[model samples]
Target: MNKIDLTITDAFKNKVINPVYLPYLNNETRTQIYFGGSSSGKSYFLAQRAVLDVISGGHNYLIVRKVARTLSKSVFNEITKAIGFLKLTPYFTINKSDLVITCVNGYQILFAGLDDVEKIKSITPAKNVVTDIWIEEATETDYDDIKQLNKRLRGKSLVKKRLILSFNPVYQTHWIYVEYFAGKWEESKNCYSNDDLSILKTTYRDNKFLMPDDIRELENETDPYYKAVYSDGKWGVLGHVIFKNWRTEDLSEKAKPFSMFQNGLDFGYAADPAAPTHNHFDRKNMTLYILDARYCYEMTNDLLAAEIKNMIDRQVITCDCAEPKSIKELRQHGVTAIAAKKGKDSVNFGIQWLQKLQIVIHYTLKEAINEFTVYKWREDKDGNVLPEPIDKNNHIIDSIRYALENEMAIIDRPKRDRPMPKRGAL
Candidate 1:
């Protein structure tokens, strides 16, 4: 076998990829998991390592995400970047139409997604065998998909085989954690042989290439939950908490209410609480200002209705759809409340949508602030996060999600028409 020259190897040795990953460059572990947070350079290192494997000859590699449409922008680009970094562009021919890169040495790298099963089945490698696979965002895929992918690693191969998995620890109960970290695959009828598994955890701190502002942004993360997961590279317990993207701000004086607004209400009796939320959306900027809230336990539906009238009168209120009786009762008492449109996957969809927006909870909504810190998803006996969340600590989140999902329809009214504070007020 021809060896890469010392000069060409320097391109890889010098800060091209983080040194934290250098030790595992030639790792033979059958299953290698690189789990971490944003800007950890995990994907970048994997790209460089995989390209090196191709250059070493006698190998075919498949890089995948959950959806095929995202391949061109993510893994494909990463591999091309690696080629440029290693100055190997002249030695490799990129077939953008097929999303494949072929090396002069008969090695090929294919990029695809699991979503398109037919396309994945049709992939043929021009090597000894398809010996290496990288599953980016492995959490998005389930065990069934992985088992099928594993079957492709058959046939004679000179190079060691590897099924590399990389993803953030977003959901603790995801199959990757269940099979790899917790080691509870017995009942699931699947297990990894002890000798073949290697797990590497990393975080933004591991990558020294981050800029000063990037480090500052990560250091200044105020959400305790996100700090533990993204910054420290720890697994967040599923069904534990949901809103790690928010923070408390004094909106009592800073944000004055505008005409474009909505409210949500959740009714409860006895030990349970009835919570209501007043929310305003800055549509142009995609910011949600949670202005105020009403939270009280052992309050009658009538009393809650009266409070809603005084606090968020005449505004369109979308309450928990499950409680049509309460919605009717609130309307009877002159509170403009309607049932939220609950359809299939509403909870997860609403949660995912809220995950994307910039949410600012006013300091005055103390109850909401408290709930945001503890709101969690529901988990099965195996600790897998269920699609639905636990009923507790979610009245505020429920109210807020309902308000946002329902109010988002009015976003087309034109942002300029919505009353904004005087230029200097904020």
Candidate 2:
């Protein structure tokens, strides 16, 4: 330990952390969870807390993520930034190579990814008991990972033994939601603290230091489902969801004979993610089996084509015809991209066609499950619910429509004018 003594006043803490997080500075809860929308400053405040905890002395802290490689730019960097912002740089020895920070007063902060089990086992605090374990991106870690880490806080210490977690709630089925949140969280509330646990929900609105351009970007986002989860910090989807017709199951074991296997693609860029799906159609039973799917942001046409190619073994892919150049690019990249037929009021027809069929999603298809949970009817500017579904956050669903457009047209046509079922897959 260094000879010099260092301290941070209440005024200094108030200056460093957002006002909403001030109350939690000295909170003694065993478990603390801070989750919400993007740019809410929860991680920043907690990062500041990690530094403050170091200055206060008496305990060791562990900062972690699901993947070891991701910590350098995320949780580890956040703490370093916080230490700089709080003007405590000289008092701590930050070992960037090992990602270990030691305070002058004998306490230390360590980082490890849950994937590196041996590294976690080898890391024991030299001075004090490991009093705090901060799991960044807690959503990526499952129950067993947390359970294993939880066992590390066995012995007693001067300070409260704490499990501090931070993340953006992406899906409802995540073990974090089931374990600590489930029925206890409410969309309207921002803070909840009990005798043993503290859960704080925040969003961009809570971040005062955010730039106007960033706020405008979040405001301009049209995807209601993602905005609810990433912008408003809502757990799962929040809206009048369109479908109760979908369920998850392991399709490989119980799959029945299907008429044909098809794939679909929806073009998106900037705020919207490019989505593509592989599915099986059982024409006889009117069931659509979602086999594999993927969504990516900031992906170019070439990358999307390569991704689609990897997902399929040279299957015909129906895609949104609005971007002919992208379709052409896919072809150039060796993807068999076919333009979907366009028709008047096709969105409505396609949605209806899907509503008429039972959609079975494989348990591994997370993106589809989240989209289906939040896809809702479009609302007018006056807030009246319209007859049509919203176009936002339905990239996979839209791709399905595009892939099965001809079939949807069959369902759209008057029954008397409908043609006999084709014997093959689309």
lDDT, each prediction? 0.75, 0.81
Clashing pairs in model 1, backbone N/Cα/C closer than 3 A: 239-377
Q: How many backbone clashes does candidate 2 have?
A: 0
- Per-candidate TM-score against the hidden true structure: 0.57, 0.71
Clashing pairs in 2: none
Q: Write model 2 residue lDDT over 1-426, tens digit each, in one string.
A: 523466577887777678888988887898899999999999999999888887777768988887676687788888899989999898889999988999888889999987689999778887868999989988767678788888888677878799988999976766688889878877677888789889999899989899999999888766666667887888864555678799989988765565477789998864577888888877778888998876655679988888898988578899999999999999999999999986766776677678879999998666687678768776544445566677666989998888777665565555323332232211
* Per-prediction backbone clash count: 1, 0
Q: Give candidate 1's error at residue 374 in angstroms.
A: 10
Q: lDDT, candidate 2, residue 417?
A: 37
RMSD of 2: 6.7
